[model samples]
Target: MRKMIHSKVVFSPEDLIVVAGISLQMAYKIIKELNHELEEINKKEKKNYIIFRAKIWRKFFRERYYDEKFLTINDLEKKFKIKEWEAKEIRSTIKKELVAKGFKFIKGRIPEKAVLEKIYDYSEEERKNENVSKIVKF
Candidate 1:
């Protein structure tokens, strides 16, 4: 069997409690919604089983929130063509920047809109060339 990178393929209620700072009751409700969505995927893929009432898929959770989207450190690393450590550092800087700008941010993830706008600045030229953005602090 292939080994997992993070030691977790699914998010348990306890994990949600810690990561999301939500109550256990809310966690269960989130899990239920995740399972329901999984059921839809099951139908499309013809999977035999899709019922996972106790957990939420981590990828799904990362791609979605309520109104805002996020980028995992891994995604940032790939998007910016940077190393993992650099991506992490940039994420930290960006997180602080966003919070100071009055936007809420979850720990260990970067807000997608802020990051893109910061790098691209609403210009295709910047998007084509990211080096001009000066992403590193020191």
Candidate 2:
């Protein structure tokens, strides 16, 4: 007997293709439908974004052809090479930042693009600080 393994992470089109034994085109169609449903839910909840910012676009493109759509806590831990507690803290911090910026977060999963963006931004900031400190020392 083959034991089935279920993933907690959000499914992308490729995942659908593998799990559902569907063609790429079919998987895309399913993704389109799911996206539409998600939009409707957002609308019903009155969660409208006045601005379609760069961050949102980044998130879209990053997740577009990827295998993981939404990342679970475990995925976050693996991606950042952090402990479970650190993952939770990072997720919470990101959530707070997004909320402050007027974005509504879907519960249970983190946006991969957002996580990547945060890491990139942090590294840039650190580099800038290091440059400033070097100049001061010189």
Candidate 3:
């Protein structure tokens, strides 16, 4: 199993309640629920999860734009017949959620997960190289 070092955080009950906007008991319950569901997550599911989330946004944009022609925000609003503010809110909400989930999203653009994977690969390679040089010198 791969291990990750994460900084420990200590939070008071009230502080956590305020941050999550839930009572301590409820927060604990939610965390318990999440923990149970998270047990199923692994590398295979993680890859599919990111892809699934991106595909959802892709579908949202496609459906929001009603016309078969070039679709703009105006077309989106007109097709959905929703207000401009509503359309804007939907887009913002989707982007915000993706970011919170560690998925980078650009307006009118979707970044490939390979970009983040490459960054991780490069950092790991650098660490390996450093370890090798240290061993050689010693």
Q: Please provide, for model 1 over 1-59, each residue's C-alpha lDDT reduced to its tens digit, 9 standing for 90 to 100.
A: 42223326667777766555557897788778768867887899888654666877766
- Judged by whole-model lDDT over C-alpha atoms, candidate 2 comes out at 0.57
lDDT of every predicted structure (CA atoms):
0.66, 0.57, 0.40
Model 2, residue 82: C-alpha shift (Å)? 1.1
Candidate topping lDDT: 1
Evaluate model 1: give its TM-score: 0.44
Q: Which residue runs of candidate 3 sit more than 4 Å off their true CA positions?
A: 1-72, 109-138
- Over 1-138, each residue of candidate 2 has an lDDT whose tens digit, in order, gives 422423433445555544434566765665564466446757898865332211122233233332234566888888789899988887788778767765544456666666776767654467799999999999
Q: What is the C-alpha RMSD of each candidate to the true structure, in Å?
A: 11.9, 10.9, 16.8
lDDT of 1: 0.66
Candidates 1 and 2, the one with greater lDDT: 1
Q: Rate residue 130 of model 1 by lDDT.
A: 68
lDDT of 3 by residue, 22-83 (tens): 45675355344333433445353763322221112222222222211232345447756878
The TM-scores of all predictions, comma-separated, are 0.44, 0.41, 0.26
